[model samples]
Target chain A: MASARLPNLGAGNYFGLGELYAAWKNPEIQEMALHTSLSALGYVDILRVPAPILEEHVFPFMETPTSTTMEIAGTPVADDALMEWAVEERFVNATRVMVIDLDRCVRCDDCVRACASTHGGNPRFRRHGRTFDSMMVANACMHCADPVCMIGCPTGAIHRSVEHGTVIINDITCIGCATCANSCPYNNISMVAIRNPDGATITDPDSGKPIFKATKCDFCDGQPGGPACVRACPHDALKRVHFQELNPAGMAT
Target chain B: MIRRSALPFIVIGIATFAVVAWYARFTWLELGNPSIVTGYTLLVLMLMLGFFNIRKRLSMVPVGRTSLLLAFHVAAGLLAIALFWLHTGTLWPTGSYERILAVLFYLVSLTGILGYIILRSLPRRLTQTGIEVVYERIPAELGEIREKVEALTLECTEKTGSDTVAQHYIGTLNWFFRRPRFGLSHLVGGDAAGHWLRGPGGAARRYLNDVEKEYFDQILELGTLKILVDRHYACQDLMKKWLLVHVPLSMAVILVSIWHLLLVNVYAI
Candidate 1:
């Protein structure tokens, strides 16, 4: 856990512009891992943290004085629900994942469509997801700290990139067992029918059934810029955020 | 603010068109074929604008960001419309061969503008729906709603010795519950489903006793959910399917524009 990245990550999002510039200014922490745990900053996974430990360290942040929904003016669905859901669903299990500013998102499938274009014409995520007002936890892979999708991979085809923690599935080794698809609780992974050069579905010879492959967002692997979805959003709505930071911000319900 | 924003593209597009328009105007004054310069210019602009599709395909490459490309594509498209008018000097072309090309061009522009509007406005409206459903999953969600409605209809019959609610399901509500209904209505914000639920749905409730009314109330709640899902279906359906028209027509515009170019060079030019 590179603790030097905490103040840079907290309060302001890692994807947020000022934070990126600030991070770049500090060369020592520039090479921090995508999901750098903040234990050195005196915080661990929120799920595992005991109350007294969190109270002394993290509780100060939670004391925003604003309560849930109507109590703080009633328009919100409660920031607590957002945090609780993130903690319970393990959305923050990843260091960084796509989050949407619904206030900004125009429901343009540009992000989703751009993702598909990057990954051989099959979109890796759904724009549709759990929403709390203008914030959406879009159903894209967070490339979790512990990818549950990796549990049943018979061939060990789905693996994390050593360079960046992007979860990539090797198309060649993948057997289309659909283990990852079923195991993914968020339904981020989809089993798309494997197609050939002429746009015909490749069939399993013995079974004579259309072969499938487990597909999801690979964080635009090997691409120069970054995730195409974030780059594709004209509205500046979509962001690849540290889910750990999102919990305290309480953007979703 | 201007440099980082799409203002540059807009500024650049206008400046280039103004330069070309000025050049074409001088050529026209000299009684020369201004169509050649404006036509060629429009063709080049179309190629640049049309390359957005190609850019979409080449996402693996490091050309530029797709969002910026789209913003530029749109700015370029609008300027091309100006150049289009400058080239032809008329909105409608009289020549039969040119008319087909003109029609195709207008269709492309119309669809593109419509798509721009859809992409701009649809997302916010979708968020207002308070639920996010995948486009493909709408049918299954509808099916789930249908199942619940039918079960409620059945419960109405069983709990009370009344088939009025069941009869209502069979008669009026059945059609609404079947598949996506009133798509055009939803598209136009007609709220036909909501109106039906409130109007005819209320009318049907009058026939029910307290026990049956309880069942109807639950059915109405399910109907409301169905309406939201249908709204998602209509909007998402429009978002994806409009590309079917816009993309192919865009490609056609390219093909026809090429043929028109060859014809102008060989015969007219």
Candidate 2:
């Protein structure tokens, strides 16, 4: 749409992509969105067209009959339940999602170790999750499309990134109430005891309760190389992908 | 990771080690003090291997990729063994202190090899069982299965009005339901568990009436599920427990190597 808007701008003579980007940057020329501006600046990819969601996963959790039903419907290994969880949780919102091809995974916990390498000492996700014959969806945040975890935060600390749609928690504002942790159906969010730099647990000054903070996979946001877990996987086993890419036939349940 | 390209790395590593060994052999014959150089190099290699544990602990630090580090550690292990053989110059060292160091080194090497074998083979076998469970949660999963079995048994007794199924529970099936039984059987890929489930676990089936047989089938279903749990425990448990042996012995070997380093400097120098 923005490309169409810019087709006739600057005397309709576009020299190059830079001139298009410069004209887009100028508010007088065109009111460019931050996402579009970022794309023009080569910082992020702007999806010019809509992505194709799975046919079976046309409805969100609220509209679907299975929203409150926690039971596995049928053939959880690689059937309806698999994509249902993905779509219901709104995994399509994020730019990329983590997927594990279990046949290639050796259970070495290298991804977990890499995650710990990025975060401080605490590996954000366990290598265990729902599995079919070999594929496993590890218990890490999917940065959901709806982000139910963000809804009940008392302080609005857990919010999606304006630029990248990454659901991030502001540690300074997070009161450790665990609303987001509880709200997450996949149990991706973990309530960890906040610790000092010396590795001692920090306690509340009055109640003496250990200070707790909810943590999970952040998609390695702001990291220079992006998603350390995905990069550190030596075996081409792990990947950050969209739900549209998953094929049930490939994973033999 | 995948061992696809590791063949080249292995070939190059072995070739490089052979060349070093030849140089060390010449030094031993001509210079009469190659053990010192080999010992120092082995000590450094051992220290690097030990640092892998530290790297695991300080997981937050982005020093290097863990698989790359682990690959280096394995390579160092192989080279260290070759260096040890060169240092002693004989299969068994005559010196009392040297013998103790050699013995400890041998144990460490053996355990490390066993650990690596366990690491390489069991994970794919685990996936074949069509079950994925966290090691810590195995007991809870077993407990839940046991609970369901117990309830089904109660229903069978109430509906059938016979203690035959109840007696079977107290006698044979109860033992299997209690915990992760037949762990060793599962580890060796034995069908003893399935045999026991059908043979011993099915002993009461003949005594059951048509109505009672239905409940027994449900019990059998839960038993099969528990067996999958047992398989998971067997694979995951061995993978974790082997490390306990490898790590403590590694620390001991390092200590012995440190002592060996001191004694040679004190007396031979």
Question: Which candidate number has the best lDDT?
Answer: 1
Off by over 4 Å in 1: A1-90, A101-128, A144-161, A165-217, A231-237, A244-253, B1-5, B26-32
For model 2, residues B148-229, the per-residue Cα lDDT tens digits are: 9999999888888987888999999999999888888888788789999999999889988998999999999999999999
Backbone clash pairs for candidate 1 read A70-A74, A102-A134, A106-B123, A107-B123
Task: Tell me the tens digit of each residue's lDDT in model 1 across B1-269.
Answer: 12245677899989999899899889989999888899999999999988888777655566767668877888898899999998888999999989999999999999989987876667666778788777778889999999999988997798888899999999988888899876777777777889878997667988778999899999899889988888888878897789899999988998998998998889875
lDDT of each: 0.77, 0.73
iRMSD per prediction, in order? 2.8, 3.2
Model 1, docking class: acceptable
TM-score on alpha carbons, each prediction = 0.71, 0.72
lDDT of 1 by residue, A1-253 (tens): 2112122233322222222333344548855332333332224333343445644565455433222221322334353565556655667576557898775565656787778877777888888777666688888888887688898799999998988888889999999999998998788888999999888999989999999988888888888898888877766678887776663343422
lDDT of 2 by residue, A132-251 (tens): 456777778878655778887999989987877889888889889999999987788999999999999999999999999988888887876567887676444677765555655543
Model 1 superposed RMSD (Cα)? 9.8
Per-prediction DockQ: 0.29, 0.20
